[model samples]
Target: MPELLAHRADTEPDRVALVAGDEQVTFGRWHARAGAVAAGLHARGLRPGDRVALHYGTASWHDYAVACTGVLRAGLVAVPMSDRLAPAEVRHVLTHSGATAVLRSAGRPDTDLAWSATLAEIEAEAGGSVPPQPPSPRDLAQILYTSGTTGVPKGVGATHANLAHGCTLDPRRRPLAHSTHFLHAFPVGSNAGQTMLVNALNARAAALTAGTFTPGRFAKLAERYAAGTIFLVPAMAIEMLHAKVHTTHDLSAVRLVGSTAAALPPAVALQLAAAFPAATIVNYYTSTEAAPAQTSMVFDPERPGALGRPTVAADLMIAGPDGRPLPAGEVGDVWLRSPVAARSYYRDGDASAEVFRGRWVRMGDVGRLDDEGYLYLVDRDSDVVKSGAHKVSTLQIEHALHEHPLVREAAAFGVPHPVLGTAVAAAVVADGTLTAPQLRTFLLDRLAGHEVPGRVLFLDRLPRNDNGKILKRELRQLLDDDRATQ
Candidate 1:
């Protein structure tokens, strides 16, 4: 990590490395500030390998970047915790990771202590020399966390080598090789956001964002900068497409539109194709635990639900109940062989054992590979619905619902049934009046009868996490509430 900053600082000192709205951080200043912070940490009696927790928001991207670099340069592990996290969530992460020091946005002045410091305090640490102890590529660099929608979030411990697997100082070999500027609105502390930070260090383009993401603002920023590559989560895609921002702004500058975090519905993909006529729409599939080991698909109308094939140098497989690899077209567990030495959950050997198998990472997703080797995700393990003797995919139902003219947003969850083990139910935010019968009719055309949602509830909006992932548990609770009322 230190080497990356030093290289950029030496070569492109004046070029902006990161942007949040109107503010920009140049490689020279960013690298220099990080060096000062590293000296400060050393003066404060923090030694190499000590865990430092950085709690910051998108608005504090500049400070966060400096802190992360400084921590790595000083040979310490950085634990990134977003400001959007709930207090309990924050406490859990801090406690579980055993972070010895905490750095947050500048709020007040405090003595530079080993336990805590502010961004202002860190910047005040005056020193010209780099910390004598710099990190090695194999040393732990950062501990990023998962979303924890189903339970407590797990901290993913990644070494510098893991994160810097493909990063290079060579201009021609940089990631996002085709773009001069890449735009995205992903939240801080997420896998997507961390990847962007990595890109800012290694990508050919200068990373750009609007800090806190709003669909309209994101679209405008891309237009304002004339970004050649744009990346976003599927939820952001849904909102932008819902507002038809393409008609409002000229997004023809984008040659590639990359969607991540979750599967992009086929309906949304079709809309994206028309919205950015010049762009090749792409769906990127990978979990926080299996990054640099996933698939990338250039949107093709011929393969409707495929999530593309494993990227260059990455291998993927489907596993049956016994954990043995399955043949093509057989639905089962999805796993990918990591491009680097596999990462593990911080201090949780049980979890590490369950998720990491040799160099392969279990995606915890139910999917299959076609004979053509394109991977199609059926559903997440928890999101799949068991309707009597048949297993159904909520994503299939959601994609079908998204195809409905009046459905603006949709989610599908399983509800307990009297006879069948579980029944499929759906919740939707409609652009206009849409009812159960109407949606059922719409689904019958696109889905199997067993796959059609048995119940449909209309709402103003679906509940979502800070990262814009729909809260299926909340939707299921709403279903239970409606049943109780009846």
Candidate 2:
């Protein structure tokens, strides 16, 4: 990263590198500021390989990017933490990663650390030269913590090579070659954010982001900047469609729209395709542990739900319960092997061993590959409900519910049943009035009798984490409360 910045500064010094709100920083200025921050860290006695935690309270993408680049330039491992994390969660990361110093934008000091500084303080120092020792490709780059909806979050340690595998300093061979600007609203300290950072340095397009993100705000930014490419999660895409941003803003510049971090529902996918008629809408499938090994499907109107075939750099397969490879059309654990090496959990060998199998990593997702090699996801293995004699995919039921014209969001789970062991239940966010019977009848036309949700409850909204994944555990608690009342 440090080397990439220096090269860009020399070759394209006057080119715009970042656009965050009103600030437009050139590559030359960005490199100099990062160097200043690196010199500041070295002055504080932080040496190579030292872990530095980056926690920010504001939505300043430029500052966050500078802090992260400074950590890399100083030959230190960056540990990015989200400000949305609770105090206890922050403490756990600080204690677990053993971060020697903390760099933050705003907020009270959340952890007991020997050294801490704000972004302003870090960029204030003057540095004349780069670090004497540069980081090697094999050296640790960043420790990204996964969103722990099921349990405690684990840090995935990515080496410099892991993050920079396909990244090239050559502008001729960039990811989005035709795009002039790539726009995204992902929060810093996320895998998606890191990927965007990589694109900012390597891609021909300048990285553009907003200080705050709402569907309307994002649309305005895209229209204002003439962004040729935009990336979002499924939840964000759904929100944009609901807001009808396409109707209000001129989005003709957008030639590419990519969705990741979660599956994009067929309904939302179709809506997005219509909204961006000139763009190629894509759904990317990959995880924090298995990045750059993505499977991208250019939204085919006929195969809207398919996750697409693995790219040449990736090797994807389905593994049965016995750990043997499964044939096409059989649902099982999805495993991915990429040219880039898999990352490991930081200080958690047991958890690492469970997911890593030689060069392949278990994606923890249940899916099947079709005869034509297209991938179809079922549900998270942990989220699947086991009834008396069948395994039910909550994602499948949720997708079906999303097909309802009035339904906005839906989450399916298994509730305890005295006779059947477990019964399917669902919580929905819908517009029109609907009853359990009505919903079941709606499903009967599309699914088997057992697949219909036994209990259907409506709510204003579903609980979601910072990454926009539904909190099933919270929904399960609601089911428990209803059971108690009965």
Candidate 3:
């Protein structure tokens, strides 16, 4: 990573690389600061291969970027965590990664780690040099924890090659090349946010982030910077449309809007296209462990449900119960092959074995491929509701709800049913007055009789993780509590 920075700094010393609110960093300054931070870590007796947890709040984007690259420059491993996470949540990451040191930003989240220092304190000491031995391609680059919608969040480790596999030192070959400024509001510790940081390092465009993400604030930044490319997850996209920020703001400069982290509901895609008519809307599909290998779909009216084919150097396969690759149009486990050496879970042989099959990463999704090989997700294995004699896709139900004019956001899941083993349920966040019967009637038009959610709950907002993925587990708990009160 330092090698790339050094070259970028030498070549385009004054080009702005990062922006957040009032602060910005050029390639030269970022590289120098990163080098200095690398030196500070060395001075503190942290060696190559030692794991360091970076616990930074969303507001500390610049410092976190410097510290992360600096750790890479020092040939050490980085464990990125957001301060927005609870202390227990943060502790799980710190303890699970077996991190020897914890690096914090100014607004540090409290933790009990023995060795901890703020980036501000570390930067105060200016007395070391870049590691002569930068991390090799096979060296562990970073460990990012999953969203933990299931049990505990597990750590996924990516090597330097995994990080740089699809990356080109030349900015011209970088993805989203036709942009002057790239804007996103992904929290710094999430996979989406980490990818944006990588883009700042090598992409032709300068990266922009909001200290705190509000739709109005994000729109203002996009308007102010004239960001040609905007990257975000579906929740943010829905919020932007709900807030109607684009109506008031000049979003005419945006040429491309990329959505990821979860499936972009087809209705939302149409709304996004109408909102940003000048931009091409693309949905990117991949997981933390399966990154660098992804399938991206541009909005096509003809194929609204397709996720896309395996991108440039990536491969996709639908594997059956026996783990053999399934033919097209067959729904099975979705697996993606990374262009670079694939990543694995840290210190968990069982999890790694279940997920990392040979060179392919099991995406934990049930999907099918069209004759043309475009992927269409069926449902997450865990999210599939076995109701009566049918298996229902919660994603399909959620997409159906989103089709309604007043529905703002929706999540569909399964609840226990004495007769059928499980029953379909939905929790919706609506923009205006809506009744359960009206939504159920609306869904009946699009979904099968069994797919219609039997129970519905209305909420002002849906609970989400830092990465903006819906927490269905929490939704189930909420429904249980709501019913108990009734």
Local distance difference test values of all predictions, in order = 0.85, 0.84, 0.87
Per TM-score, the best of the predicted structures is 3
Model 2: pairs clashing at backbone N, Cα or C within 3 Å: none
**Each prediction's RMSD to truth:** 2.2, 2.0, 1.7
Clashing pairs in 1: none
lDDT of 2 at 144: 94
What TM-score would each prediction reach against the true structure? 0.95, 0.96, 0.97
User: Which TM-score value belongs to model 1?
Assistant: 0.95
The residue-by-residue lDDT of candidate 1 on 167-232, one tens digit each, is 898877887767668998777788888888888999878988777888788889998888999998
Off by over 4 Å in 2: 107-110, 126-130, 480-486
What is the C-alpha lDDT profile of model 2 across 404-440, one tens digit per residue? 8888888888888898898888988877776677777
Candidate 3, position 270, lDDT: 97
